[model samples]
Target: MAHIKSRKHPAARRLNCSAAVALAFIALPGAIHAQQTKPASAKAATEATLPEVNVQGQAQSYKSDQVSSPKFTQPLVDTPQTISIIKKEVFQEQGATTLTDALRNTPGVTMLIGEGGNSSARGNISMRGFDTAGSIFVDGMRDLGNFPRDIYNTEQIEVIKGPSGSEYGRGAPSGTVNMSSKTPFAGNLNAGSLSAGTDKQKRATVDLNRKLNESSAFRINAMAQDSGIPGRDVAKNKGWALAPSFAFGLNTPTRIFLNLEHIEQRNRPDFGVPTVGLPGYYNAALAAKGIVPPSKVNPKNFYGSTSDFENVNGDMVTARIEHDIRPGTILRNTTRIAKVQHEWMATAPSGAVSDGSGSAAVARPDPNTWTANRSRQTKWQKNELITNQTNLTTEFKTGSIAHTLSTGVEFIYEKQLSKTIAGAGTMSPANLWNPNPSDPISGYALTPNGAQSKGDTMTVSLYAFDTLKLSEQWQLSGGVRFDRYSTENNNVMVDGVRTRLKSSDTLAGWKLGALYKPASNGSIYASVSTSQQPPGGSNFTLSATDTNINNPNLEPQKATNVEVGTKWDVLDNKLAVTAAVYRSENTNDLTTRGADPGQIIQYGKKRVSGVELGVVGNITNQWAVSAGLAKMNTKVVAGSATQTGSSLNWSPELTFTAWTTYKLASGLTIGGGARYVDGMVRSVSNTANAATTNMLNVPSYWVYDAVASYNVNQNLALRLNLYNLFDKEYVASLNNNGNRYTPGGARAALLTANLKF
Candidate 1:
């Protein structure tokens, strides 16, 4: 495993649609209003100003769409970096009911499997070549740890790539993803959806909004889903999530808002299709007859009534308050606390096929029986994270220039507890199968009875930033942050190998950025940032010779990045285009070597450079297109040459994605899109010419999708979605033993109906 460099990535959002798709269709109402209003009436209304655009879920002092004011929609062009946003409307339109499903089409983003049943392995969004676990943010606050993320209350997802120590605390060398929750509205917005699809998949979602008073409101949302895997091993997996939120505006220059969310997601991890081998990636000659890759395996299983995966549950509470000191200076504060617990287990063959390879040398049969062996993995994790942040903004006039200065500070604390139970056994080839109807595989148990290991760690951080307006056409921003993170753990091995580990790390990181708004709709900017990675307690596990190499005295990893970009608004805000090129270098990156008990060492350096182009908003009133292209080149600058120049695991060099929606008539619309990834090889060693003979390189491929919707009325609609239209064959998996390859699945379709009143 190569060093895991840090890079910022996109945040988890409820919707998958791009900004362009929403802007295109949203303009219909304004167009209709114009046609219905007479010239005289329009003139009177424009002069009198009926009312302001009430921005939902914001403090009273903050107005909506203030060109010179700070707002969530202020756009990434305002900063000297790369930014992209995915709104909630897109999610509903595309029927993206889950976080994982929604991220598939996000620009320059890739999902990385953590491998094994480790709760920390559930899901990760990677940028460049760095893991983004600690780089994720919810509602502009830190929620980082070893827990998986869910989108039960998210309204929109924002992606900021490159080093962002300016806004985020000690962060990722890659980038950050911000999850923004849906705010409360003053009016009534009652919307609900019911969806049913193949494999007994059923789901129901409802959102209720009500105005509590002239200046207060509340919104409650709940969702329940039960679904089965459709293909080969269709295991029954289901769960439910709930979110409730409220907002208030005080007449005495004060405001308060609260949001609570509880999520329980219990789904089976597709450990993978039984790998006997099927050509393309898996060696067909090695696979059992009629066995399909895990990707193609039907969700329904033929084995038994149980699944071989794990169970995950998460709970969170978020709150904020805002106060206006004067017309120009205002103070805003926010806090969030969340806890997540997970238990996962899986049964796999010792000789599995993964990473498009088939040597099977990493996994040999139990010496006694030249037959297959069985292995089991069990892991549990409990994590809690809390963040507190405050910001102050003021306006001043200098000569002919109007300057609005903003400053803020952030404090974060995170705690993580983890345990693991693992072992393997050799079985008589014949006894591997369930022979009797009375007894079926109920999943494997821990190898050593009562064998469990536990460890915990805590991290604390503090930081601040400032944004300056130099002139109406120019904005300059710069910020600095500092963090002090530490961890401690206790582990008792079943064989009396008791170990107590205590490790603490303290580091300071900062960034500088400048934005020049040459015009009202366009800007050019540049930024430089830094990030660090701490050594975990697990680093204590090492061989005698490797102990020195894995020195607990290991320092935090470091990375620096510089980027330049330009943003433009074309056709009067109907189209927004952004382009950026960046170069990042990592020093003392933490990477694993060898299998299972891989030695953790800071021994690799990498350089990554890439150019990305994104276009959002509408191309025309009736036709909208959202497209993005990312070309990244990665090289191991100071390590073994073999793995250096090769693209890192899960880092595809060329990525292309686009979605287009055309409004056919009044309330009818159709949309379709496709995503493609170029081929890349997975390297796991620090030596040049590191044995490619037995390695596997996933081939490039595309996944096509289409959707159609009919607006039955003002508040009701029907939508249908088709995924993998061609049933393309490709593997989107990564793991150890190199034995977890899955053939891309065949076509699948779903339908949903939404009702709003």
Candidate 2:
């Protein structure tokens, strides 16, 4: 078993933490002095005064001149056990177009680049030892699908680690990511950007907010992009998105909002990268033998073509209503409806095959020989989800006790339908692989003709929570929840047979927590939480050629998580730092055990321990930075033996990211950062063959990105971004099919312009 040992001493750790706090203390006074001394520039004066939009229910800090602070990002921090927020400014500076682009550099997340390549279906992002599995939310509303996420409507990204049963129902033991929308403001304003770079990359985005009245407003945002292969021949991504929003406020005590978003994407796929044994190792040995393997292999020929296909469309509608019942008491209700559809297909390399006699070592490129070739696979899915969440929160003072109580009931209904069609190199007579390079690869099917698997899922939950102030400096919080779920799979028969079944289950979860606020701006906390996941339909099997893998006799994957953390704002709020230590165990773990080449049984038990550290603040008025580090050790304590000690697929043991921005002048900013992930393994198999063992363990890699922007005026700006700055080559995920996976290309750049009119 390989484990990472922490070498820092107790006292040293404490001192480093103290230094961060001291630095924050020094920034407060300096910032105040700067605000009082610097005269307003003409550019700042040219922008009109706009109504404030406070995300945290605060007012004063919502104005144009102030930067969002810990106070403004507190709601999530206070409600969830662990939370992290990535601001809009950071996204713009990074030119993030996908969730992986935004999360790859996050401390606790490592995105799995699937063997299917760049144009293949989007892969998964692991957080705290569990997969995201299409479990994501927009404006605090649940939406599940395999669709890739684009950054057009994103205002901010927030990640909450650990069981979220109190809010999100029946999710993985890991965590969830929430995306906030760009809201409407009472003013005439605009912001947009444009860029063109490598791989023939081009992009444009525009945002507009208008006021309908003192109590009503509307907002619209649009994005478009066109790009080509930045690396291998078969990879490409192109898409566009449009989002419109509206909000109304009858008075100070009541307000309501509605949002509608739509997106469309067309992608050219690239999945596998041929492995040319890296530089020093293979060459030296081969040279000594007076024989050398080619530096690179194309893995394709005139008669063997590789390509990817993609088409995606989605829509979402969300609404929120809130009423201030009294001084600190409020009543709120939120609801959302969403739909998503996707169709994707791609071709990738399959490992070498030996002849029947076992003596033939000749290069096998023809489909008829069965030596080496690419397999074509296709997957399509459609999803619909609707959630209605209502809560009543009351904060009141009774004698010496201050209490904030929140009671809520949430119900969510989700349904998904999907089909997969897969075929090998030799299928039909017309699609036969040409043995000769001079022949054309025509009359062949780019996508295989296969079978379809369908299913429907439903989940219902109810929960309640309360926060009690025990003393001036101490508080206690606790919550409990109950859930019910079920799934039914309808199979499409091959020869006229009913091969399907259904299953359901009920579960409960709870959390207990305590906090000590030594000062108004610092908090030390400890919490114990529990979560549950319904029996997924794919866990069972009933036959050989036909599996009765419908939802049947399956149990929920459950876990208990214990965590300790602290949040401190030093230097009078100029610097903020957060650190945590956590241990989690899954009693009835969910895992897969292969029954055949393309089939598996899913079930198990697992345990994990980890630590996290983060810092976000201004080093000085002219400089700002945010950085984080995370390390975890996860083991299948009790489960299918094959997966016991293997590094969990996308969950890397060590992950780190950092960003720094330096203000060059009155209105100019430049910043750059890097994301690092220690190598990882994606799968576990029973055999010792190279394809089965090595395909699961992918090596480590690093990515670098940079940005530069200038304010033309208070309401307008220009910017440029360079991504994959060095074009580092690496693969994201691999499987036993003898196919190696490869991520997208490198060394690309883009330019953008934003205007507020």
Q: Scored by CA lDDT, what does every candidate get? A: 0.60, 0.61
Name the regions of candidate 2 deviating beyond 4 angstroms: 1-80, 113-120, 232-234, 276-307, 351-372, 397-399, 420-451, 537-551, 590-603, 640-646, 684-696, 735-738
Over 60-95, each residue of candidate 2 has an lDDT whose tens digit, in order, gives 110011212111112433432666677666666777
- Give, for candidate 2, the lowest lDDT window spanning 10 residues: 57-66
Error of 1 at 7 (Å): 23
Reference-based TM-score of each model: 0.80, 0.80
Query: What would the per-residue lDDT of candidate 1 be over residues 1-757, giving only the tens digit for each residue?
Result: 3333222211011223433443533453334334443453464566478664543321111001112213221455566677766666665666666555556545667664456333233456667766565677777776544444555466777777876665565566788777777778777788899988765768888889898887788999888888765453444456788888888994547788899888777776554432233233443322333333333232222322233556778888888888989986778888888887877664443233322333433422222222223444566666677777777777767776555566666666666555555442222221222211123343334444443444444445555555666666677666666665555556566676766666566667777777876565567888888876555522222222223322345665677899988776555445667778899887775555455455455677888788777776665666666677777877776544345455556677777677777777566778888887776555534342322222255567788989888889878889888878887766655444344444354577778998888
How many clashes would you count in candidate 1? 34
TM-score of 2: 0.80
- Backbone clashes per model, in order? 34, 14
